[model samples]
Target chain A: MKRKYFQRKFDIRTYECDFKGQLHPLALFNFMQELASTHADRLGFSVQKLMQQKMTWVLSRLHLKINKPLRWGETLTGRTWPSGRVGKYALRDFQFFNQTGETTAVGTSSWMVIDLEKRQPLKLDQLFTSDVSLKKRALADDFPALPEIDNSENQCKFAVRFSDLDLNRHVNPVSYIAWALESLPEPVLFRHYPMEVEVSYRKEVFLGDQVICKLQQIQGTESLSYIHKLFLEKNGQEIARLRTLWK
Target chain B: MKRKYFQRKFDIRTYECDFKGQLHPLALFNFMQELASTHADRLGFSVQKLMQQKMTWVLSRLHLKINKPLRWGETLTGRTWPSGRVGKYALRDFQFFNQTGETTAVGTSSWMVIDLEKRQPLKLDQLFTSDVSLKKRALADDFPALPEIDNSENQCKFAVRFSDLDLNRHVNPVSYIAWALESLPEPVLFRHYPMEVEVSYRKEVFLGDQVICKLQQIQGTESLSYIHKLFLEKNGQEIARLRTLWK
Candidate 1:
């Protein structure tokens, strides 16, 4: 039987770290995405393979929890596996470990198979029947609808660049989190580090598009959370919404 | 004797590639920077070591030529070495090779040792005496001054985000090029690929700073060239200028 899991090791580059010498959240997300793609390719379900059938994968939502902050020059092993399915969504889970084999982060993500021509979600069971370890889940929480931001305290505008587009021709999902983080207040950004992040992608963003990120903060007894909403500047269409917790 | 040259191998990640499935220029630059830092660390001249002595290395200029475009999922070996010192500037060079050992890209960069407190350039001879093979140069051309943009044609404004800053608490040099590329015509960006790029960094950009990138095209006899200037939006301080040849 084909192995249901994939593992890849990565060395943290200096450019991947922030001023605090810790790995930036965006870099971590990039690593996860890379691992997921590689695994999908190994399973004969790569984007190219799906494209041949006029179907492509679209990330719907992701929830990541970082147990420890990864630092520069540290080598980490990323392990990912297919984690069953829910309705039209395909579930994947990821775990990141440090050099000493400590779990640094764990993530659960939901993706949808989409018909490129019709621009609609396709049923997963028809196209995706790969072996998934239904019992193994990195994160215990199921994919839930995130709360909306009550008020926006800060915001930033961004013009999508060519570099922001990936091989799929749409804006890379990691860029959304990068812009969301940028919309936070200076004190919140520099004083704290993100320990958890949940992102829900609503619409596709392309090159030459202008987007604005709106940030709203919520204070809790245990942790501080911020909700970020990214919207198309031209039509006010929602692109993505993210909730991040800092400590 | 310590090895003067450092070599590292990297697997191009899926996220690092563009719509063409070729590695992005910014990713190539990031790989070069990572290789350079690793080499410096091995030579006991890392940024941390320099910071201990109240000094730091600042990139002054760089010229990179891509003989062939690198593609996603390909393994490339990057080799970098300290070439020599020219007056107050220390010269380093880089060469990238594909799995077949074909030279894919080459770059030469100039750096200066800066006194952190005084913000002054220090003499290369005073603090740096590392073994450098003066004869080994990746590129034959001397570090030439990059041309300034004549007239602003396309422009984009950006606010420095925390993610843009590296461990040095300043904007990574690669981000400057990313912004410069964003300030170009869509046809030029999507149709042509940059074959050669030269950049001269004039001023440092920090967090919360707003900057604007202005692009100017220069039609040459054989090739099309574009000049990009990134300036501080508040005071109009020229941060960096880049010249790129696209084919």
Candidate 2:
């Protein structure tokens, strides 16, 4: 029997909306941070306490899906649990609920514990001796698949802007999503919601450089999937390739 | 001599940071949106066009700031200019710059040609005008005086979680500046700074808020001339208040 880990709840604020008055995709990422931090706190590990121990949690990969739009002023609850441990990695699952107890969105994230001094990955087993019991739930099997990179025709370009960066002084992964999505028209982009997303960063983007974002769409009968590529450009020199999957 | 309407230059991404690696201040605001949009198009009459039609912009006002920080990826420039004319409301000032001269934030705002909308004590003439060749410069002032509120200590209780409600489904206005200056210990709250700020709302904020921020001391004495506030909360509240002056 799998042990059940503690669940945490968080409220929604108005400051998380876009021009359309709905929560922006990037804002959802921040909510995930809060949910995860709260869960850690209940489990004898908090971000603040970890920092005191010179340790941090770095997000290696994230796959998310938004089934419904969250509106402003609506009180929403976010619940999270750790699924399992794999070598040096930990898989966590999240579910967002509305005031009515209906699920609005679901997310799964892969994280690595790191030693603050060495910045090296640490194993989950080394951190916790017993399994943090979370309600036994099946892992999401509907995550979007990774995109295939074809060095041909699908070309997208973007300039790395200061706003695209984050506290790590590195280009925020979300900015890549914005760039990739912005390539589409406003009407189409706004009308069709993001049901699933998968992104992989090939290299880091730096300051004062122009970036190129490329995309290719794979059409399906009922849904569609896209592959995105991001590159740093200076006089046509390629810097990096970022591949993303969106449906 | 050329007249200056508004003068402020800041690195693009630097404007968006806190202690953590999240987008520090809320990104969607009417003022910031207008600045971004106008900056992208570079059209002198966009604001005028909107006003001439007697259609004004109204936002729900959602401002939130976070303790998570933003990193540096590329060079960003933020600029504000005047979008000329709307009947008695002549000079509409806007600020927006891009990561690489491309607008990332943009919007269209409404200024009352007549104060009839709010039924407040002020009138249109007391606000603005369109004598383009006049010697009056809008940018002359570095910081506008804080609007004198009824400053009752009883009315000024330290904002707690419940009071942090997003009445408009967005973060409350009172909390905007508070979060931006969170990094400063209580000793710095009362200190004065030479800073200029203008925040126009696009949405609202709601409960269970957590804000974290810091102070960026510019040139001059460190005796209190620089202050900032960021509402970096999880539930939905995020706002930013920035102040800078010669110490």
Candidate 3:
């Protein structure tokens, strides 16, 4: 039987830490992204091959809950597998484990196969068939609905640059996460860290484009949850929305 | 006899690329940094151990020349070793090799032992000593002097964020390189990629400090070289200087 999951072990680098002395969200998301890419490639759905067909995987949603922030020099393993599909979107899940084989973090993501020529999502048959045999979900959770953020307390503009792009020439998901995290107030940033996040993508950000990020509290002061909304500074069209559960 | 050099093998990640389908300078510097730290740990002078003694290795300068930019999925190895001591600074060198052992790039850096509480420089004695059994320099290179960036055409301010810091809580070298790259205009960024860089650190940047990056072309229209000078936006105190050779 073909294995339903793939594991990649890595040692957290010193540069991957943040001001609070733990793993940066960028690093965590990057590892999960890397694992997904590698697993897809090994299963004959590599990004390069898909690009030849003018198709690419676009992350549509992500829900992650970090149990513990990894420390520098610590060894951790990321295991990811396909968690079935929902219509045109391909679902995947990830688990982070320490050297002792205990899970330390978990994440789930939804992706759409976008065709370059049509500028739309392609069907699962058009791309490549996923391993239907594997039916595992890392989280026993559902997609959280986005809370309306009526008024934003703070907003910042970002002009995408060369460093913001990837081999796909698109701004990767981790960049958006970094931008959202950076937009938060220093007090909020230092006071608490995000234990869970639900992100939804509505549009693509290209190089040289100016985008604005607005941050505000989603619910009341009862539970710490903030909503981050991103839009094009030119047209103010909503591009992405994210809600964070701060611990 | 003690081993004098350490080599780590890895492939470039998708998040590490820029506009072109090649590796970003920040990613290259990061891998080199990881190798050096790992080597130090194996030699019994790891950061954690040094921190117990209230001492840490601070990167003072780094000079790197890239013959080619690595592509995603290309396997590469980073080999680094101590070259000797340069007064209060410890000298080290690095080389990036392809899977076939062909050298793709090279770099050199100097580090200073700093007393954390005292906020002062310390001699190499305080930190555990390196093995003197081997004395081999990776390249016949010397530190480059700071270029004269008298009047800069482009200037941008970067407020040190939680993501910009490292385990040492100071802004890392790669963050400075990223800031300099981001400060360039789109035309200049897409037109030229850096082939060589020599960086010098004068002062430390802390959290919430807005550091100004001033960029200008050095020399004439002959060989492309640019100078990036960083300082506090408010106090105008010099922080770091970087000279880049463009291809």
**Of the candidates shown, which would achieve the greatest TM-score relative to the real structure?**
1
- Model 1 lDDT tens row, B1-247: 8887999998999988888888888888999899989998988889888998988889999889999988888999999998887888888999999999999999999999899999999987767565555568999767777766667778888888788887678998999988887787888889988889889999999997999988888865578888998899999999999988888
TM-score of chain B of each: 0.96, 0.31, 0.94
Query: lDDT tens string, model 2, A34-141?
Result: 567656766767755677777867666676778787865576777778877667867788788788988888877667778977868887787879877453432364
- Candidate 2 residues lying further than 4 Å off, grouped into runs, are A1-15, A116-119, A133-145, A151-173, A185-187, A201-210, A234-247, B1-17, B20-54, B58-247
Which candidate ranks first by lDDT, i.e. highest? 1
Candidate 3 chain B: worst-modelled 10 consecutive residues by lDDT: B125-134
Residue range A23-64, candidate 3, lDDT tens digits: 777788899988998888877787777888888888889988
What is residue B220's positional error in candidate 2, in angstroms? 8.4
Model 2 complex DockQ against the native: 0.08
List the global CA lDDT of all models.
0.88, 0.48, 0.82
How far in Å is the alpha carbon of A139 misplaced in model 2?
Answer: 5.0
Model 1: how far is B3 from its true place, Å? 0.7
Sorted by DockQ, highest first, which candidate order results? 1, 3, 2
TM-score, predicted candidate 1 vs. hidden true structure: 0.97
Q: Write the candidate numbers in order of decreasing TM-score.
A: 1, 3, 2
| Model 2 Cα interface RMS deviation (Å) | 12.5
